[model samples]
Target: MPCLLLAAGRGERMRPLTDTTPKPLLQIQGKSLLQWHIEALVAANARRIVINHAWLGEQIELALGDGAKWGAQIQYSSEETALETAGGIRKALALLNPEPYFLVINGDVFCPGFPIAAFTSRFQAQLSNGNKLLAYLALVLNPPQHPDGDFYLHGEQVNDKPRDADFEERKLTFSGIGIYHQSLFADLKLGEAVKLAPLLRSAMAKNQVFGEKYAGPWHDVGTPQRLYELNQSYDPK
Candidate 1:
């Protein structure tokens, strides 16, 4: 499957740093955040990649040319303005549309060792089954900054609400990583700014979304403190 690395966010919270550079290009531990994801994706043998950019997008193009250095073929989706998650995906549909399922990763999040091959394998298993799965997400424990969390995961299914009265469910934060069927963004128009949560929720209500809790290392590098702390304390196991 191909992959889409979302790099178009304005990164308001990462001011000063993001003021001069795109958030995905910000360095952490030696490599730029976006590079980490690219290397991981290449390592997993998912080489064809698409990156969308708006703010300081030129620098992103300069920083990682054709991805040939990493043995990956990369194409770019340029937006005149920063389009939110869903909108960005919609804009890049031409590149991603070739495959029925494509992986999307947040450019700002730093989860270096994430098992892309394994995750996609699991998602493929879900797809091969008779059930029509629209999305498969990787959920993580909520960080201190976002204690309320985002979605509920019940068994292999993801839910917008805790519907099962008899079974307990854990609300988990979206790891900013997921495999999506192209149809999920079929209704969206190019260049329109839109968030991805509402679409996921709609799919969740229909039991079309599946997710698994990832216990591996994951970090949402949204703020300066989180970035600083990760640089100072992160020890790759």
Candidate 2:
């Protein structure tokens, strides 16, 4: 499946660092966050990459070029202004290929051992079995910043319910990684800013959304302090 890296966020919280550089270009262990994603995607054999950018977008193009060095064909979707998640995906749909499913990940996140191949295999198997899923999210344990979590996962099914409603299950944070069917953005207007949560919730209500809890090293690099902490603790060697 083709991959889309979302690199267009303004990084409002990242301030001075993001003032001149896009968040994905921020270095972690001597490699740009975007580069890390590209290398990992290439290693997984998802070689076709589409990166959509808005804030300092040109720099992203200049930094990564066409992804040839990484053995991938890179295409870019430039937005005049940052199109929030779903809108950006909607705008880049044409570049995502004709396949029914594609992979998407947030650029600013740092997830070292995310099993993209395994996720793809599972999603494909579910699809082939006629179990139509609009979206399959990778959920993680809630981080300190988002203690309440976002969605509840019961077995492999995800729902927008409070954790107290089902004491047996715990709410999980969205890791900003997933495999999505093209139909999820079919109704979205191209280039319009729209958040992905509403769409996911709508799908969840219809039981078309599925998710898996990933117990791996995942960090949302939203602030400079977090970036510094990651760099200090990360073993690049």
Q: Backbone clashes per model, in order?
A: 0, 0
Candidates' TM-scores? Answer: 0.96, 0.97
Q: After superposition, which runs of candidate 1 have C-alpha atoms over 4 Å from their true positions?
A: 165-168
- Per-residue lDDT tens digits of candidate 2, residues 112-200? 87888898888887778787799999999999999989999987888998546546666899999999999999999997999999999
Model 2 regions lying over 4 Å from their true place: 162-168
- CA-lDDT, candidates in order: 0.91, 0.92
**lDDT winner among the candidates?**
2
Error of 2 at 98 (Å): 3.7
Tens-digit per-residue lDDT, 202-234, candidate 1: 998889999899998899999999999999998
lDDT of candidate model 2 versus the reference: 0.92
| Residue 132, candidate 2: C-alpha displacement in angstroms | 1.0
